[model samples]
Target: MKFLKVGRVAIITRGRYAGKKCELGEGLKTNSETEVLTEELQVVIIQPQDNGNKSHPYPHALVAGIERYPSQITRRMSKAKQTKRSKVKPFIKVINYNHLMPTRYTLELEGLKSVITAETFKEVSQREEAKKTIKKTLEERYTSGKNRWFFTPLRF
Candidate 1:
C-alpha cells in the first residue's frame, strides 16, 4: 500500500478539523496490538497559525504548538463504557484516512524563507476561490425555498 508522504496538504473531512486544511507531519510505527486495534494507523500533525478570523476558536491556539491525529479510531460499543485509553495525552482532534480528503496542494518545508513562494500562494488562492464559487452556486441552486425539505409537508 502506498503511504501518505509528509508535507502533503489534506482536508479533515471528519472530526473537529473537518473543513480545515492541514499539512502532514512525520510517520509513526505501530509496535503493538492496541495500536493496530485503535487503528492509530498513521499520524498527521498540524501547526496552528493565525487564520485572521476572530470567531475561529483555534486561531493560533494549540496545546503544544502542534496537534497530532491518528489515521483511525474504532467506534464505541457503549456510550458509557470506555474502550481504549492512551497514556499519551490526546490530541486536540482525531480523524481517520477515510475522512481525510487529500488535496492537490503540497506544503514545502525546506526552509523558513522558501516555505511559501509567490507562485504557490497564487495557486492556492485561486483554488480556494474556485471552491468558494462552486459552493456558493450549489447552495443557491439546491438550498433555496422548499428544496431544503427532504419530505413533503403533511396536511392535517
Candidate 2:
C-alpha cells in the first residue's frame, strides 16, 4: 500500500463523508518563526482496534475535506447571496486508510495550516468556526481557477 502524505487529495468511499473529496493532513509549522517549515505530517501506523471491524482493520491518517458541495449560482439570488452560496462546506474526519480512494490531484491550501488545528476538532462551535474560514479559502482557490477539477463534485 502507498503512503498517504499531507496535501494528497482523496475521495472518501465510506461512512457519512462517502464520495466527498478531502486533502490529507494539515501542514507542518514549527513554533520557531525563524525555522518555518510547511512539510507533510508524519504517517504513523497504529494497532487495529479490538472491535473486529474487518472492512477497516488498521486505520491510518486523518483528512479534512468538503462535506457539502457548493450550491449552484441561481439568477434569482443577489450578488451577496451568490458569493455566500459559493463557499464550500468542510469537515474534518479520521477515516480508515482503505476507505479513501487517492487521486492524482493534490491541493496545498495555505490557509488550512492556521485554520485547522488539533483544537479545531475539539468542540462543535470551534469546528463550525474553522469550517467558515476553510470555506472562504476554498472559495478563493475555486474562483481563481486553481484545481478546478478537484473542487467540483464527483460524478458517477
Model 1: per-residue lDDT, tens digit, 43-150?
Answer: 223332233123322222111001222122236544333222111122222233454555565544332222222222245574345334423332343334222221
Model 1 reaches what TM-score against the true structure? 0.30
lDDT per residue, candidate 2, 48-108, as tens digits? 1222234334544456676666677879999999878777766665666666677776677
Steric clash count of candidate 1: 1
- State the C-alpha lDDT per candidate: 0.31, 0.59
Candidate 1 CA-lDDT value: 0.31
How much lDDT does candidate 2 score? 0.59
